[model samples]
Target: MTKRSDFLAANKGLRVARAGFVLLVLPHAAPDAGDIRRFGITVTKKIGNAVVRNRMKRRFRALVREILPEHGLAGHDHVLIGREGGVERDFALLRKELLVALDRARAGKGDPPRGAKGGRGGGKPHHGRGKGPRPAPESPQT
Candidate 1:
């Protein structure tokens, strides 16, 4: 899990959404004999400035430390992505959400509900101002 490849692989795995954050779980296909569960925390700049992001990371790390040992499975990789409200969200609520999300993900119910369409362009495509070039700039007479 120390490698970037592991993180990238985990990105393609199961995703569970919570109010404060999102959890990605990927079971290792061929874990080393000594390999246990591994996890990562990611709080992007979109969440806040450096200070706020760091605080979120610290909080998430603490949450993982407390939750993973009992609830996490061996030979799996989990990555937690902090959401917008994560910085100020209640720790207890976040913990509960994490646990519930994990259970749903394991049960294969974490996926979007039926008839739920995902991604962009689900609606009519925007013409974007007729897709024409801008008018030529008028040259100022010197």
Candidate 2:
């Protein structure tokens, strides 16, 4: 089992690699370091009741165990936070999401760069220019 100290140390050491579904916080550790990377799972009360939360945590742990050896940074600490939907989400989808997040993290110098956006129909700027028409005033309700 992973140790708490390792997670603490990792949090202290490196920047975080994050995605919408998961956040990976990695610290710098040597490839040959004897230290076993640690993992921590956190699911907030907003997710669900104790049972549901526990289930989410378990799923996250399993996913981490399965993917860590292949994608984990040798000397980093990692934490996975489960959203409310995470508990009900399919395992395969979760795995795919995690892997995509990890890949971006790895490729971009251990943390995905900020402002890198992607989504359905492509990412468009959220704000309209000042030239856009203003909204009309609402009429009085009957």
Candidate 3:
């Protein structure tokens, strides 16, 4: 769960959205030695400044710790992505949402593809972020 690759892999899993967060559940083809559940939380810069992000992270950590052990699906990797304005919501409300989301996930129901919405993730891939590829290094300046 600490590695970037772990998060990326979870992104390809089932996604359930709530008012305050998005839950991603990915099951391992086979569990590790202990068949334990592992989870991670991500709060992006878009959420706010460092302090705000840290606060949101703390809340997420508390919620996961309180609920996951009993309600979570075993042998899966869970990732909670904080959404904008999540910080303003009440913790109890968020906890309820998480529980509902986890139940939906346990039932193998996930929200629709986020890319289906217009003007966002879906579209042609950008060739590159730069103006364009360098022009063959100008032929080594002749």
Task: Estimate the Cα RMSD of every predicted model relative to the unseen true structure.
Answer: 8.0, 9.5, 8.2
lDDT value for model 3:
0.90
Q: Which candidate is the best by lDDT?
A: 3
The candidate that wins on TM-score is 3
Model 3 TM: 0.80
- lDDT of candidate 3 at residue 41, scale 0 to 100: 98
Q: Pairs clashing in candidate 3?
A: none
Considering lDDT, which of the candidate structures 1 and 3 is the better prediction for this target?
3
Q: Estimate each model's TM-score.
A: 0.77, 0.60, 0.80
Which sequence of candidate numbers ranks them by lDDT, best first?
3, 1, 2
Model 2, 30-61: lDDT tens digits are 56655556677878898888998888888888
Clashes of each: 0, 0, 0
- The digit string of per-residue lDDT tens for model 1 on 86-129 reads 88899999999999987887786766532356656367656666
Writing each residue's lDDT as its tens digit, candidate 3 over 4-55 gives: 9889999999999998999999996564625678999999999999999999
Whole-model lDDT for model 2 versus the true structure? 0.67
Give the Å shift of residue 96 in candidate 1.
Answer: 0.5
Give the alpha-carbon lDDT of every model.
0.83, 0.67, 0.90
Cα distance off (Å), candidate 2, residue 125: 23
